[model samples]
Target: MTEQGGTCAIPGDHHDTAACEHISRMLARISDKWTLLVVRTLGNGPRRFNALRREVGEISQKMLASTLRDLEENGFVSRTVTPVTPPQVEYALTPLGKEFLCPVRGLAEWVVANAERIDAARASYAERRAGE
Candidate 1:
């Protein structure tokens, strides 16, 4: 009964923005530059906070903390604290986050596979610009 491509269950109705906020948040959480790197690093195994900082070079402490908190809230990662001396804390991916690995890894592999061509395209554009 609905018009073509209308999202609402009722006829001729539009999609509700508020209804989609959760998905919006989910997409935003994992799509940021630092988020992808952090998740990918955690996919390997649990690592101490310092190790994460080292692996993600150039990232500020505040950014790392915020990113981890978001991922933890979204159920993509787990944070554990140990009671031993110095009180250690570490992070690792949840199974949900682990599920994101193969597809993202494929994307990285595709970039590697096409890097030469992409570089050549950029170089060609630069040359053309310089010639003008």
Candidate 2:
């Protein structure tokens, strides 16, 4: 119930408005612009902070740091600081995080595969909204 997209005990044992609200917030965090990309990239392997920044496309430093910290807090990532050198640091997916990689990648693939149709749907919705 913490942050995973699962049922909630709030209100009742059965699905409730509180569960829906929890789901919405969880999606907001996981599907965040940087979080999604960061998880995808980290799925490949552990990476240094700068390496992650470069690989995740266009993410600001502060946003990336915050997202990584969030991911770490959510048990999706592990952060380690090497004692050697000028204090090297790296991040990798925990077992739990790895469990979600396939699903996230599949969602991304679905978007790519249906981009045209999805875009058309969005444009139609926008046009309908404008006319309303």
Candidate 3:
């Protein structure tokens, strides 16, 4: 690793230091628990705020709003408003966000496949630590 523009970047990689930083920041955002859940929930289809909240579960209103705002600002999600009685608002994934789901789903599948091995490894590690 090399320090470039105060961010740690891999040397000799195709990506420039700025590109590495951008990727790191985006990874942090999408890898967030709420962000992942929200994105997965939105993957099904567009949803109203309350419906999204209900589906996401255990997320506070403020956190969900903040996550949606960040996703929107980052162009991963789109917000639409209809001029109805109460002006219905909906949130859905953009093309980029839809593309992102590929890796996310892959990661989820990897976790499911490795869960038993992971649990056994963790148990062994805990046993060794306790003996220490």
Candidate 4:
């Protein structure tokens, strides 16, 4: 990498600043609750539309469809449609999506592992607030 005007450019590349910003925005997008849940559900295996909705729970049809579209656009999920008397659609993780599952699962496991500590902290904060 080379530094130019306080911005580091990767070898043979341009727009490092823009790339960083874009990646940050993408991270925020996928780190959202709906996205994470959708990705996690898909991690288990391919799922049809209605099945995905039921598994994710409480996500409106519109929201789930939107989330799946976003994930598909991002190349994190693959959508396949089979034709017959009626069309059948299934959603599964792409290679990229499967790669993302590792970190998401790790983060989820960490949250579960720390839930008690987090609750304790929240309770302590609430007590302090009550005193105030």
Candidate 5:
């Protein structure tokens, strides 16, 4: 990567600074912990707000709401409301969201597969640091 003006440009890509910034912002949003968990949960199928909240586990209602709003605004998730009685609200992943899941699942699998190795590495690093 090379710095052009104030933005970093990829070695071969032609995106401008503004486009790069937008991509960075989007990657940050989708890579957030809450967003990842929510997307993974929704990948199972559409879910009611309460069901989704329950399945995601440990995420506060407020945080889930904010995450959902952000995902919907960015076109990764869709929200549907049925106007009956108290009304039913559901959230589901868009096609883009589903496509995004491929890499997310791959990362999750890699981490799971290497968790023991990672733990050993962390322990080794800590031992070296303590000796210093």
Candidate 6:
């Protein structure tokens, strides 16, 4: 492995460096608290604006709107508008977004499986800090 831009880049593969950079950027975008929650919520199916707001609980209207816009720009979600007297907007995971679920769910499962160990580690750190 070679290090580039402070990232461990795999060697001997022509695309490895570029691929690592792309994956790093994608993870930065999707791993945010709100983004992950939004992605997971949309995994259920397409949802209207207000419905998404309600389901993603505690997200401000402003933040939700911004998140959806970003996701749409990234090709992870699609925004559809229904032509009616009152235009209706719905958001759904695109195929790319759907493929992202595997890793996201893996993260969720990891958190669940390690909760106790994490808590214990935190407690040990606290005890050490207290002694220090």
Candidate 2 clashes between residue pairs 3 or more apart in a chain or in different chains: none
TM-scores, all candidates, are 0.75, 0.78, 0.87, 0.85, 0.87, 0.86
Instruction: Evaluate all candidate structures by whole-model CA lDDT and list the values in order.
Output: 0.81, 0.88, 0.89, 0.90, 0.89, 0.89
lDDT by residue (10-97, candidate 3, tens digit) is: 5556447678878788788889989988988898999999999999999999999999999999998999999999999999999998
Minimum summed lDDT over a 10-residue window in model 2 is located at 1-10
The RMSD of every model to the true structure, in order and in angstroms, is 4.9, 4.8, 2.9, 4.7, 2.7, 2.6
Tens-place lDDT per residue, model 5, 51-119, is 999999999999999999999998989999999999999999999999988888988899899999999
Give the number of the best model, judged by lDDT.
4
What C-alpha root-mean-square deviation, in Å, does candidate 6 show against the real structure?
Answer: 2.6
Candidate 6 residue runs with Cα over 4 Å from true position? 9-17
Q: After the best TM-score superposition of candidate 6, give how far the Cα of residue 17 lies from its true spot, in angstroms.
A: 4.2
Q: How close is candidate 3 to the true structure, as a TM-score?
A: 0.87
Q: 55-108, model 6: which lDDT tens digit per residue?
A: 999999999999999899999999999999799999999999999877888898
Model 2 Cα displacement at 96 (Å)? 0.6
Better of 1 and 2 by lDDT: 2
lDDT of 2 by residue, 97-120 (tens): 998798899999999999999999
The sequence of per-residue lDDT tens digits that candidate 1 reaches over residues 83-130 is 999899999998987987666677778989999999999999999999
Rank by TM-score, highest first: 5, 3, 6, 4, 2, 1
Residue 107, model 1: lDDT of 70
Q: Indicate the residue-level lDDT of 20 in model 5.
A: 77
